[model samples]
Target chain A: MTDHLVEGVLAGDRRAIARTISLIEDNGAEAQATLAALHPHTGRAHIVGVTGPPGSGKSSLVNALALYFRRGATGERGEGGSPKTVGIIAVDPTSPFSGGAILGDRIRMRDLAGDPGIFIRSMASRGSLGGLAWATADAVKVLDAAGFELIFIETVGAGQAEVDIARTAHTTVVVEVPGLGDDVQAIKAGILEIADIFAVNKADHEGADHAVMALRMMLDLDLGGTATVLHHGRLMEVVRTVTGGEEPPSQGPLPPARPSAWRPPIFKTIATRHEGVVDLATAILAHRAYLEQSGQLVQRERERAAAELETIIQQESLRRVLACAQGEKLAALIDRIVRREIDPYTASQHLLGG
Target chain B: MTDKKIRVLIAKPGLDGHDRGAKVIARALRDAGMEVVYTGIRQTPEMIVEAALQEDVDVVGLSILSGAHMALFPRIMDLMRQHGLDDVLVVAGGIIPDEDVPALQAMGVKGVFGPGTSTDTIVRFIREHLS
Candidate 1:
């Protein structure tokens, strides 16, 4: 059964691919076996993560991007005559009270369905807090092994700390809307740091130019383009403000830090109208080129592997300790820690020792 | 709670602009620990079947208040078969009449829910009917 399923997945059988993803979502023992067989065939597809706050037009933008990849900017195949097979995994949050979710991202992506070149999957963030579901990585591997050239992972409407998409995707497009805030809602350290491209969707709406200007101003600060900023209508010490009103941390007898060469380009878009999406798509391809030329692709892959290893180690160690010392034994350790008889670090050491 | 959730697709496929009943069933099924994919108002049969194929849903609850069940169910049922969705338990709700229930059942709609029917009944019917 496993060999047949693996063959079917490698051949990109639709039913087999769907069933494999379901198994991954269910997290059964059979899933591990199947995934192990499929893992060696992964990493060919380019995974792109599109994330932003609620109602930021992420779903529509993903739909537009998918359409662009499968068709093109002019609604026909542009340049490359053959279309690229695309896969989409859209996520929404599960209800905390009921442990259920309404995965409605498909509603915006109605046009992509029934197309042989595209496969869309909707996921719910089932208790995982970091923008994506627990099984997203595995599901992406399934699609990757299924020979999709490009895969887009759309996160649940994200907040500042929900930047986990960065670890999973090769190119991260941070979607922002106008009037969200003065400096733009995507300007937070977490959000700004993760963006390979910034798309200000809903450009026809008011405040779009201002939003673009705000993002440009902030990126300029990071790019060392300006020493001053118009903050609250005041000219401010940008460097000091960036350093939290303190002197810059100095590295004694060391070379000064240099900025990364690739700057995330900001694109204005009306996703519903398919406006500015071509430029956004071009920016994505350009970013991929930069990553390849700069050798950052291999570097990022290493980082992702290391992070996954660390996470698995952390989870497995905790699971092992819990399996042996659950119930009163674990409760006693927790009670001792709470009573200040033992610190958590020491408790962990003891747990590991025994 | 079971790790394997019962996924259901609740869709309104008709000209009915009012979908309060569909939304109600969607909410109830969600609260009952099922992942409900509610494709908002006015979906076609092709769209509905495509969703079921992708989602691998255990049940598909079609809510039609436009009184087009006889006209729509056959196409939906045909498409479901064409897509090889033999194992999916299909049911309907919202403003269905008593006399139309037999035809709908013969067309492979296992349950027909009408006005004032308890949400519990719909839930129980799905739970019991799904293999």
Candidate 2:
């Protein structure tokens, strides 16, 4: 049955793909069977992850990137020797109370829907800590097996936990824009470290240059190099030289330069205009090549596989523990915990052991 | 026996900060006994697709008040096609002008709902399509 699903997917049957993804998302017996059958046909596609702070035009950037990939097929080095097929996975946060996802990503990427070669799916994190829905990896696998040359996973910018995309994707792009308040500090830690490329979207804004300069400085820091900082003392000295008066070179010492481990390239773009998309795509492809050449691809994929296994185990274990405690016993335990009679850990242990 | 519920994913894509309509539709859908996934704001086409796949949803409803519908809807359709989700109905709401409706539908969007559309109307449309 899984093989039949794979054959249908490869033949571009939308219903088959949908059903297969449904199976994977549910982690049902059917999905596992399907994946096992399709596993052999996987590993040929390039997976890219796009993530950034909210309001950075990530969707627009993705739209443009899809267009760029489609355009790439018209040139040399193209597979299928025709319009390339692309898969997109848009991950959105779910409402805690509703167990529902507000899968609103279609608004920004409507332009590509008409194309026959592109497939897009929206996923909800369903309160998953990593900003990646549990179903994402399997969905990507399904698309990969279906023979999409490029698969994009777009994640909501939920800061720390969202960095999981780095492990799942072959290449990760971090996106930002001007006026995001302390642009550098806003993304300095966690997910920022995982980005292979940084995009400065909304370049049409006034402070884009400053944002770019700050990003470059941060990149320099990441690369273990000192970035030149124009100190107030130096500025005062220059002012005094021009004025020939007594300001005595302002008091504060120069800002210290911090070195870094890797410097991701920053590209400016007005995502709505589709400007700079070509360059961004080129940089992404180039980065993919770099990863492959540097042997990072193999390492990354291994790490991703390990993490996925861990996640699956954790999820399965949690499911078992929860299922074991359901009904009257579960309700009673919850009542006890809430009433401070027993802690959650003890209750969990009791439930699991029983 | 209860009627089969319609599962809907209501998402806000790109930089649009407005979500009043998205939230309203989510509630309306839920009230109608359709499980709705409200993906807040700032979603990409990829995120929306992933949600639909995970939730095993029957409809993907996009709320775009930012006038980005033209550039966004097509990417979603393309993804649906690639993932073989053409049967999953795609709909759009929120501030959509009349002129773009035809184009949106042409791109495989099942329907477009603008402001002033009641929850009952939207829910009925989804049910009718699903049925």
Best by TM-score: 1
Candidate 1, residues A56-83: lDDT per residue as tens digits?
Answer: 9999999999998888877775445678
lDDT of 2 by residue, A1-354 (tens): 777787887776665786787666656677777877788888889999999877788788888889768866243335334656798988877667655554556667766754667888766675577868777888998888777889999997556447778777888888878876676474456666666677889999988878877766654443332343221111111111111111212333333421221236678888898887867887777777766765656766676677778877997888887887789999999999999999999998899899
Q: How well docked is model 2, in DockQ terms? A: 0.14
lDDT of 2: 0.73
Model 1, position A78: C-alpha lDDT score: 49
State which candidate has the highest DockQ.
1
Q: What fraction of the true interface contacts does model 1 reproduce?
A: 0.51
**Candidate 2 error regions (>4 Å):** A1-3, A72-83, A183-187, A225-262, A327-342, B1-5, B8-27, B30-118, B121-131
DockQ for all models, in order? 0.55, 0.14
